[model samples]
Target: MAALAHRLEDDDHLSDADFIKISNLIGQQVGIKLPPSKRLMVEGRLRRRLRALDLASFSDYGDYLFRLDGLETEITYLINAVTTNKTDFFREPEHFELMQKKLVAELIAQRRDRLPLLKVWSAASSTGAEAYTAAMVLADMVAQRRDFRFAVLGTDISTDVLDIGRRAIYPAEQVVPMPPGMQSRHLMQARRPGARPEVRIVPELRRLVRFDQLNLMDESYPYDRDVDIILLRNVLIYFEKADQAKVISRLVGHLRPGGYLLLGHSESMIGTSITMRQVAPAVFQKT
Candidate 1:
């Protein structure tokens, strides 16, 4: 039995057919394209799932995944395993800089007495860094101006990371890049000698943001009111161009006319069906 276990572990190779099958499943379900070049990465990530289920090989795992009973819950595990949740606070600083210097100023100047609220959406808010960062900026902007109010909605498909964001606690390294004043004002540190330090977002800042599980592939978003700013950064590159167009169109529909859309520095809307005109690098304004 020990020898059999060793052999099964050794036979964890993912065949080309298995890779294609898994890729198709991911694309059909989540709209993420796993091209041939990512075969190795797919294998490495799915290996953990195999071990968790006590499956012997990728082929066996594939069979089980497509089987009627396994189809329901395992797909959630598959997505959780395959979804990449890379994010950092204040990633791509220029977007936030643009918000602080230009976008917020314009919104504030245009605001009327009755409608003094600013609505921001962190569309792909992985682990809540981006949402909290936006909250920090908006909080500071409204600090002296009592009439100005703002709220941030952070959404992602990953339930695990959303839980972490809800906890509002993070490792020290994640908090290191934040400026001193922002850190002092918005975070409380938990530290002990000879132990790793952690940071928690203050309750005031936490109250300004909310997190939810949202899939961009859905035909429509869950928002009730049109948002003023949408941060859909770093997530478009995962989908095929056609899927990108569909997702972007749905996302843009949620934005209020004259609202702003921000994408990752590496992403763009040139080929997509999104009609918002580019006002700055990776920034678009809905006309």
Candidate 2:
């Protein structure tokens, strides 16, 4: 760890031109922008990749990344290195509160004729926390009334994080913010013989969520049926305005009429031309 940190601190090979090229490549492929202000951050993250490949500098890494064979194989590592996965269980509490207060209630009211399955897509679900949290709530609701069923799908561009999420074993600190009752009901203590103790999402909650690798920049999502609600929070800030509009439009096309779209509190649809109406701050309902 110390050696890795020292190598990261020594990454002075990220020249301005190399940074721009790398940043542009990431933006083109992932729709996430890394501006000049993020050069140091980009350098720091990619240094580990450089060390792993035994590359001497960012310039050689860029050359290798853009090479014919590198495009096919190295790009995965490149994207994994650059993508940010900062998340917590119930990171934004009000969104889930709104789900419990309004969305779930509406689903129950329409349970007679409407579809019995409530599909939720956590569209940039990093590490599965958001998706699991959604499952915990929906599972509890299902326990109360057996009239409806809910399934949560978590998707992200990072396969590495998706794998971790699929495993569902997290550091104990990850569940500390969860309410004691919820922690008990949805998670189980799993202690390995030689490893630090961890918490795993119980089998019931794990059954309700499925993770997939998805890039929001794609023209259309791979969903067979439109989703009932989408939790796409805290991801748009990484995109440029035009990219944000394009991604929003594509996501809107995947929502069932009257379904809700939740964004980060700091995000807005000010310039986007979409059919959604702002039902709450940073919350849009598809028309």
Best by lDDT: 1
Q: Candidate 1: TM-score?
A: 0.91
Residue lDDT tens for model 2, 1-287 = 99996775585667677688778888999999888888888888888888898987777777786653576777788888889999999888888888888887875575465548898999999899999989988888788777788899999999999998899988888888888998989888865523666899999788889999999988888884468889888899999888888888888788877788888887855423556777777778887
Deviating ranges (above 4 Å) for candidate 2 = 1-11, 67-69, 192-196, 269-273
Error of model 2, residue 168, in angstroms:
0.7
Residue pairs whose backbone atoms clash in candidate 1: none
Specify the poorest-scoring 10-residue window by lDDT in model 2.
Answer: 268-277
lDDT string, candidate 1, 140-184, tens digits: 888866668899999988888898899999988897778899999
| Over 4 Å off, model 1 | 1-11, 191-194, 269-273
Would you list the C-alpha lDDT of every candidate in the order shown? 0.84, 0.83
